[model samples]
Target: MNERRRGPVLIELEDGPDTDARQGPAEAPREPGPSPADAPAIDDPDGPLPRPRTMEMVTRLIGRPPSRLTRIFINSGVALFAFLLSIAALDFLNGLLNSYPLLGWIGIALFAVFTLAALGMAWREYRAWARFARIDAIQRRAGSALAEGSLDQARQATRDLLAIYHKRPEMEWAAKRLAEHQAEAVDAQSLLTMAETELMAQLDQEARREIEAAARTVAAATALIPLALADVAAALAANLRMIRRMAEIYGGRAGAVGGWRLARTVMTHLVATGAVAAGDDLIHTVAGGGVLAKLSRRFGEGVVNGALTARVGIAAMEVCRPLPFIAQPRPKVGNLVTRGLRGLFD
Candidate 1:
């Protein structure tokens, strides 16, 4: 009776096919790959490096990799030159032999010896130039590695760089520190920081002294000299020297291109911040009637310019050094200017 009273073919709509049983759980949407903008850009190591126009031309003339036809031409030219040299040398030797019996043999031997020596010297010079190029290239690679945050590669490059300083007592400490850093397993930033702290201490100190001296000189020139142009010229000269020294310290002995780059960097810094000329009392100095006031004004201007020059030097360091100021904060332009102004008055 209860079975007969059961609900008439009641379909359980809520209890239909279990989605989990039929289709299983819906798979999560696939994740997208990184966008092009998000992808990191790596510098191509085999790409052409920056060089002065003169250097580029010279490199093309001598060190450039030749094509098949170019190589054939070069070989042919070298062969022709060698053939001409042999003909000239043989003729001279023959003349000597005809003129004097004993002297002729000696002359022939001497000529051969001199020719061999000359060739050896030329080869060595060529090798030296090539070595310098290779060293610069390695430095460029190290710089790139540092930029990419590749510490191991940068450290290895630093160590290899020490090879250039062999037998140089002045750079002995740097060599030692580089060796020490290489011996230890450390991150690139740490190694660079330590190198900057310890190995670069002397260089930094020397740079500071140079900055101070330049500042004083420029200030003296500006204050003591009557002509505004003279003061400006003096400032320019001091700034240039400071920049060049800084570049050299940072292992970027400036070729024309490098010098131009450094100059542009300094000029850009000037344009962007006006950090160098911020605190100068140029009008008061120029208009002031009294000798003391004028002297003080000139001194102040010099100090300001020198301070700016120092800033340029610091910027040069950043430009020339492969590693950036990642581990430590770079000095602020405002802070530097303030300190410079204070020092000038004091």
Candidate 2:
């Protein structure tokens, strides 16, 4: 039994230099991996990314003019629809009159009221277009005066400017100053410059305030509102209001239809001039790319929207202004954004 025992046997090996040499050299001790603390920090998961360019896209869509065929079709459709609607309404009214005299009278009265309202709206639109034309005339006169150095043209432009602002109480002081100093200006350039210094300065400040307010509104809406297309709508509405206010400040006094028209004009100019893209780069540079990198994506988008709004505001200023910037420098997007977005990110 002892000879045949199937018990487990154990073998022990001793460590030796010869044994170590036989085995391939032990892997060089791995250098300790850098501590987590030593590792470079990652950006915040919520940190800013590239702007969505929602506003810019919207601007382009609105700015692009319809083709002639499209315009014709739209016009024809609108006219046909209106005609059909009118015919239907009249047929309904006649039937009502035959069946229910009292109700028909009421309907007639309602129709009359609607007609008057339509007339009023048309009148207002007419006035708005006239105001825009007047602004254009003043700008042309100012340009001509400067180019030709014609004192008479300058004086005439000044007079038109005065006439435009005479009704506003805010302009009384500036108008007085302009009238007083304008006489001292011997040359066309000097007179217009003086007028700009006195009259335009106030308007410019007001316009800037409007732009800042609109920018703030757009930025806030873009950052906070998560709903799709909400930011675009807000941006469009804010821009429309801003453009309308600009027109009023510069004496365009645009009505609802006219305001939309003016906004289209501004967006068209911006798209054509490539200012929209340029403005984006300018804003990124001025705001410091790092600042946006520290912000959340939505917040970064908001900053960009606000900056583009400032650009639109500036363009609106150029369009609505009765005179081109001369005595005062055109407001820079960088400066405006810097001032406008103050405390927003902080």
Candidate 3:
């Protein structure tokens, strides 16, 4: 019986070997190994994510994480203390004024003068604000004309810009710069560079001076004013002045829309770069007890803000510049800070 089946068995073995050689034993049906979704989730293979909240950043800096209740209590205590201090300061001033009629009368007169001056300033600010729209319009028109490569239109735009500057002595530098290419048959980019160079070169010193002055003013106000809000108000005013001055210096005084846009952008830059908080940290580091501490903190804050302002001014320069700095090296923050700090202390 085995001899009779041998031929069939031999034939089956030969067919199996041929099938295995051709198809390689069919791969055992591959049990669908753990899917892609089942794999461990990975962090950004690129880099770390950004922190959104200021307080979150604060927690990281301080090392020890405080509970929500503790943070709330601390903030509440600070607010209460400031409020009580403000009330006491007001009461003290009132009692002093009551005791001294002459001094009170002098204070009244000074207050009236200040009120008038403030009104005058408000009127001037309004007028200046009005002029910004026209200024922005002129700049846009010129920029567009230049983009079209129309030399005549660019020259006309230059003339228009100069027309505004002719009456303002503060804009004499810009006027002079623009006057150079007012009639020249140059490309828009070249003309724009000349104006930027003239306007921005002088700004290194002027901007620092302005920021330092603003810092001093903030320090003085913080030292005298009992309310923390007063410090905020002073800083706001100072920033406005700094930005406005920068725009003017850069030969492109921004309109209300432009000013707001610029301010928003600059503030965003400060916050994003941690420049705003950096100033606070610097002040806190040098800060101690009493009036001197307050002044020091304010001063440090101002310096930090001023440095930020300088950065804003430099940014403004970039925004207003018609052409990129191909041949020249762009201004560096380190140099600006060094110069600004020197100017501030000096």
Best by TM-score: 2
The alpha-carbon root-mean-square deviation between model 1 and the true structure, to one decimal in Å, is 24.2
All candidates' lDDT scores?
0.56, 0.82, 0.54
Pitting candidate 1 against candidate 2, the one with the higher TM-score is: 2
Candidate 2's C-alpha runs over 4 A off are: 1-49, 279-290, 343-346
* Every model's TM-score: 0.47, 0.81, 0.43
Q: What residue runs in model 3 are displaced by over 4 Å at the alpha carbon?
A: 1-127, 145-147, 170-182, 197-205, 215-233, 247-306, 313-331
Model 3, global lDDT: 0.54
For 266-332, candidate 3 gives per-residue lDDT tens digits of: 5554556565453442333223212232345444444444444445555544444433443356664
Give the per-residue lDDT of model 1 (tens digit) for 1-346: 4565656686433333454465555566579988998776674334322211221222233223449998799899999999998899889889989988788899888988998997877665565445545555665766677678788776776665676554468888777766766657466656666655555555655655565555555556655678746666666666667666766664555544344445666556544665434344322322221233333544444444444455565655554444455444554434443444456668
User: What is the Å distance of residue 68 in model 3 from its true position?
Assistant: 31
Better of 1 and 2 by lDDT: 2
Cα miss at 154, model 2 (Å)? 0.8
Better of 2 and 3 by lDDT: 2
| Best model number under lDDT | 2
